[model samples]
Target: MAQPFSVDAVVWDMDGTLVDSEPLHERVFYATCRRHGVDLSDLDAGVFVGVHQYDVWNAVAHRFPPTVSREAWLADLDAEYVADQGSLTAMPDAQRIVSTLHAAGMKQACATNSAGVVVAANLMTLDILPFLQATVTLDDVKEGKPAPEPYARACTLLGVAPERAVAIEDSITGLMAARAAGLHTIGFASNHHIAAKPEFHVLADRVIHRLDEVLSLVTMPAAAR
Candidate 1:
């Protein structure tokens, strides 16, 4: 393949985009809520899927009050996630895309709404930590997804402008952040929401169901070769 346009960097969102961790997280979150005797029976856990952790608490505070404080419930969930980290798996073709891009010498960074601890845990579990040149967690920015700060910070840390980079995301929150940061966004519609909620994925410059498809989009036009 010959090259015309080149992608200088890739900003990734880890949970649902790169790994099948969101389902596990959803189960753990509800289980922790029940352990504390918080009733989430009425609320569909899916509603909280793409929201930031801090915002999730705020959104569910009154309706799903846990026996412990908000932070404690989150701590419990995080610990459960760590304990079950082994159950997590990389999304189909996620490792392939990352490895291929890494081999191609493109810069990469992970910008996740999750805190550094969870981010590091999953990255290590997937053995993808080495391929990523940088990681920007919620701890690294004033604001996380749905806000441009996290993605922008990732671009800065990667030494690339947002326009020169692309972001692979699986949800509205992260896609909004990437678009706002001035990067081309690819929406991974591995779940129903991304495929069904066309209005929600409006920020995505392109939408693909599989992670491997990203390679073709990021690379140059075929005619250029």
Candidate 2:
């Protein structure tokens, strides 16, 4: 049984955790790279999981000809992603977990490395915005994941101390950010990008294969401690 710990708030990672958009993102990223004449293998996509799109753009720019403007490449990718929002869906148990937490009177927020534009589009598409009290994006922080700034800023925005919050993540980078912020971390392994990583085993406080299992943590008596 998981021990209970009290938290005034809960923070979430948007892409793979709340929304089943990882596969879509991989597809879009690869397509975008191909359009820019940059080739990325499946292994490359897996390795880049959890990084910000701009970071990926920078890397892609380095690999491709300098003639490819980073801003243009990023803009094209963003446009494609936004257009595909209609096909986005909430992860299994995501809606239920968020709804349950809201009903339980716990503060909820989304802290993601994605840009605000992307975050807002997906949140609206998945219809999970009503349950989110705060939304922090890369634009809101000086650095992206693995830096802890985003997660720290999110805790500040929620008026909750890091130790009094729980974070759900699906990537090693996201886990590192949440852990660095001193928040309890739960790793969701539903995404192939993270499922294959050995680091996840020791990085997260707990790991769950389905989004619904997340509710178990919130309800666990240990979580209320």
Candidate 3:
């Protein structure tokens, strides 16, 4: 028999899950890499999808050798993305679902591998910051996604047990972290950037094609599930 789950809280992964920023991320990263003298013509950008920005930098720096300091490269990328903030938009039904969950008395929080500054910007832009009762950013956890610390911290802050919460993630990396933290995971596949992959579906406890689909899962009674 499948174990019953009672969800009282929803933990969200910000980047590709709630915000449509992966294209912006890829553009900035590629430009930054090229400026730093790294040749990526032979490499597919998809490999970096759903990956932590810092981890991507570290891996690329190690593999190709960096002509610029990692810190400098990161600063440039962050600045560029921030400057292009007008391009950032919430995922389809993102704000509606978040507000609906909040109205339904769900304890909601965001756990992301993005830096604190980036998190603030994205949340503010999406206008969903006020609905999130708690937020765990990359700066809040020493070990980010794939390590479980981010989601663990978010659950702790929300005062919810891991098994009693549902984590919505768009990347395989984030799914691993949510599973490690013992939260029921939903793969948000609003776009083809990352969660559309088979590995994501395999890892997620549930796969949702639209943000509104989350409404049913979180609202369903434990007995029904």
Error of 1 at 222 (Å): 16
**lDDT tens string, model 1, 1-225?**
423235688899898888888888888888887887777877777777667788888876776544557788678878988888888898888887898888877888999998777887788767887899999988888888899998899999998888989998888888888889999888888778555786556877787888878888786323334
Each model's C-alpha lDDT? 0.82, 0.83, 0.83
In candidate 3, where is summed lDDT lowest over 10 consecutive residues? 216-225
Error of 3 at 128 (Å): 0.7
Put down candidate 3 lDDT per residue, 1-225, tens digits, no spaces: 334346888999998889998888878878877877777767777787667777887777764554577778778888888888889999988999998878778888999988777787798779998898999988888888899999999999999899989999988989999999999999888667576578888899888788887876766434434
Query: Compared to the true structure, candidate 3 yields what TM-score?
Result: 0.91
Q: Model 2 — which ten-residue stretch has the worst lDDT?
A: 216-225
lDDT tens readout by residue for model 2, 55-120: 777666677787878778878878888988888888877788888888777888999998877888
Model 2: how far residue 28 lies from native, Å? 1.2
Better of 1 and 3 by lDDT: 3
Model 2 earns a TM-score of 0.92
The true-versus-predicted C-alpha distance at residue 77 of model 3, in Å, is 1.3
Worst 10 residues of 1 by lDDT: 216-225
In candidate 3, how many Å is residue 149 off? 0.2
RMSD values for the candidates in order, in angstroms, are 3.3, 2.4, 3.1
